[model samples]
Target chain A: MRLLKIIIKNYKLLDDNFSLEFIPKGRKNIEDKEFELNQIDDNLYTFATMAVIGKNASGKTTTLEALAIAYDILSNFKIKHSLNEIKNNNKTISLELYFYYNKYLYYYKTDLGYEPINDFVSFKNEELYNCFYYKSYSNDIFNLDKYSKIINNTVLPDDTSIIYTILNKITMRGLYYWSDFELSYDIDKIIEIYKTLDTNMLSVVVNLLDEHIKDIKRENNNKFMILYNDNTQEVKTKKELFSMLSSGTTKGLFLYIQIITAMLSGADVLVDEIEIHFQRTLIDNIINLFKDKSINKYHSTLIFSTHYPELLDLTSRTDNIIICKQNKKRIIVENMYDYNLRSDSIKSKKLYENYFNTAINYETLMNLKKELMQEIK
Target chain B: MKYLIMCEGPNEKAVVNLLLDNNLLIFNRNDLLGLDIYHARQLVPYLVNLINSYNCSNLKIIRIGDKFTDKLKIPESIKHIIDYKQILKCHTHPELEILLIIDKNLFDKFNKEKSKIKAKDFAKKHISLNGHLYDNTTQFWNDYFKNNIKNLVNDIKKCKKIGKNKKEEIYLADLLKK
Candidate 1:
């Protein structure tokens, strides 16, 4: 299943509406550009790469966290551990996600209210069909006609989501969402995927780095050894290299493994602060890989948040870059495609500069700096 | 009929929408496109590229902005662009048609009297044409579309064939002076 769009509302600094769109639509002037484009249908096309740009605390990370939380809710069939802690007071924290599973579109919306009591409400639609509809703590009111005719009138407690119970029955192994982490926890899985992939392709990626990683082999006791270019007899454990290698090398390794795992699993990946601890050139190469259709043959969608302007510069399509900004008391999220811009004349760098330096955003930065100073005192 | 009108910001976008609503400007389906850029400097390179992309003599590019003010700062990235008309009038692509519209009091920034200012001087100048100079762009839009739809239509009619010849610039200059 490929994730398309996510709408997050009233969560943390994201008190207002924040949405991310992975697909580009309604453009009559699409030409062959540098980036690889995936055809959704006759007219709609989307970029595999997505980058989020914003000032600090402007809800860049919050947007990714919302997706991670939604994924957790779908994967685990339960509420996230910190959902209550982050939800706005007395307001409904809602999340709406659209995904393409098989050849059908699935839309899922959830509303968690914190009024008299914390309650969960959900509505899901498969294409034109209603999959699941549940509200409040009602008994046996779960509607699943459009979802599955065979499972009608199933009694689900308010605490349990209808989708959660039926998710196992559905084809959900293809969904893969990752939160940005320094340590690569799925090292074993990464090694498995790495072993199956073409050795030449692995060499191409490994050679891109200065470390010149000849290969990564899994050893005993959850430790992996990296073979370097020295060729003489130098093998370093992953733990030993953690202290010797630059932060960029470590991040590049994790990013490579994450990309390989996502592609092999045919799952959408959500990463926050992707440009963190990575060199500019390495980040550019990673973006190029995402843009290359052959490399991402499975069309694994990538949604990442970053503050790096160079990363934004690498983006060619308007829909590929999502902008997050803090308004009066709310966060407004918009993509290049939202403007309905038809020409390549509207470059990403210009838009990034215009957004970051606009008077409203400038004032936001100034006020934020003042608050930081006050806290320091 | 194929034209692009890039507005400075949201207020100008409202002005364009108002013009379209009252039939001040005529469009054939997707023939018209509008963009809202925060800085006039940001529009320069885009205008340059548009001029080169579609070399059609019938293609018109209209860029509307507020009256050029003395205090406004231009970013260094587009410092070479110099004047707004510089983008409209590309040396390599003189056939590139463009209509540069500014608000009233355009002469105020240049320290020139409105009546004494000749459109020919502006033809050589690269300054941004001002929209409603004295009033804000939104108020000017309201006053024009709400009160004088006929005159707005006439100005737009004159604007349609504007970049085809230099005479339209003088005509527009005289009309804006009013």
Candidate 2:
């Protein structure tokens, strides 16, 4: 299943009626098969990679969290676990998600209400539409008459998604999400999951990030053998291994392993702060892995956020880049495609120059300088 | 409806902001396309993309510049979306400094020596307020016209009658409300 678009309202810090599209809106500049997939229809295509970029505390993490929540609701059918992770005073959140499954486009709309006292999320209203990809593309998919309303206001469990009822019978595709703060807790899980996959790529990733490491081998269930150029060390815990290996190697190993596994199974991977702990070239290599059609045959999507705007130069299309900005306490998300940049334009330059008003404030920086100088005096 | 008021330079931008701030212009801040005046000479692809991104059908492009010799051309990408008729050019010629010259009551003297000295150089030498000479900065223009907005409006109106062909060109005063 591939996500096409999402419209979120009253969700965390996101602006009301905030909408994001995963597909190219108007003209398709680059025709590379790896850049986009034509699984649904020849005329319709979905991006293989999408990036969210913004200043600090500008809701880049919140945007990713929201996407993760929507993904969880669609894939797991349980909002209870995801709701616990998000803290919002808003009484209700509304989501309208569009995805492609089994040659059919499914439009799912649900209004979820949060009860602060009970600490529970209940579905207030739900609606589902199943339509043909072509018909929905040519006409307004929201027009109920054009499509079949398979589910409407159906009563379900308070914590369960309405999609669970429709997709329960069939096996659904998988979605992998890695939050920025999940590294410490995910290290052990990454090891356990990595043990099942091929170790050749992990060795290559480790060698690329850290020259000291010769190889990393999983000895058994609990222990890992790190073969350094000078010596070898066997560690039972990830903490000991992390102490020996560079942070870049450990994080790169974790990220590369996930990317490889996701590619193998054609699962969508959403990563937050993709540039952290890794060099620019390594980040470029990770993005190139998804863009290379030969390796990523399943068209698995890689969506991530980054503080470095230079990394945006890797994306060929503007639509694949999402710019987040804060306005009056609401987070406004805009697609770079709407900004009408030339295909050959340097995206990083525009971002660094604050062309989109996403860069840090110069006045604030000067104020900090003054405050620091006064303290020094 | 969306109005994209594109200024030629920072000085023109400041003048537009002053008019908008004092509610002396026909279009308010809310009527602007991007909530800011643009300064690009041509319709840049980014600006065109912003216009195309909007779902609104009625969008007018207003170009505020000192010179209109070069025609404003919409890129081919958005030609189907934005028609040539939607674009309006409001010239501040012979130069934007003409505003400073007129505001200083030196237009008649500058006109006699116009062939010898340009309006910009003339303003730099002649136009000054409280012993501070005009430096052609946006801040200077804002300061010079902050209290004399009515005079600035009248100067724009007076300059509209000098040397310009009313049939072919639109002036800054045309953007002001009656």
Top candidate (DockQ): 1
Q: Best candidate, lDDT-wise?
A: 2
Candidate 1 deviant stretches above 4 angstroms: A28-36, A42-44, A74-92, A112-161, A164-204, A222-224, A234-238, A338-342, A346-349, A352-377, B1-178
Q: In model 2, where do residues sit more than 4 Å from their true spots?
A: A33-40, A87-89, A115-120, A135-145, A152-156, A169-179, A229-238, B1-178
* Cα TM-score per model: 0.52, 0.62
- The DockQ of each candidate is 0.02, 0.01
Candidate 2, what DockQ?
0.01
Docking quality class, candidate 2:
incorrect
CA lDDT scores, all candidates in order: 0.51, 0.75
lDDT of 2 by residue, A264-309 (tens): 8777778888877776656666776676555777767788998887
Q: Per-residue lDDT for A1-377 in model 1, tens only?
A: 55666677777767555776666643423222213356544434556767777777676776677766666555555554435544444455776766554444456666655433554433332122233323221122222233433343666555445555445443222233334443556444445556667766666566665456675555654465666787633456655655655656555655676677667765556777876676655555556556554466767667788766655545445667677777886777767566666554435556554744322466777999999999999
The lDDT of model 1 is 0.51
lDDT of 2: 0.75
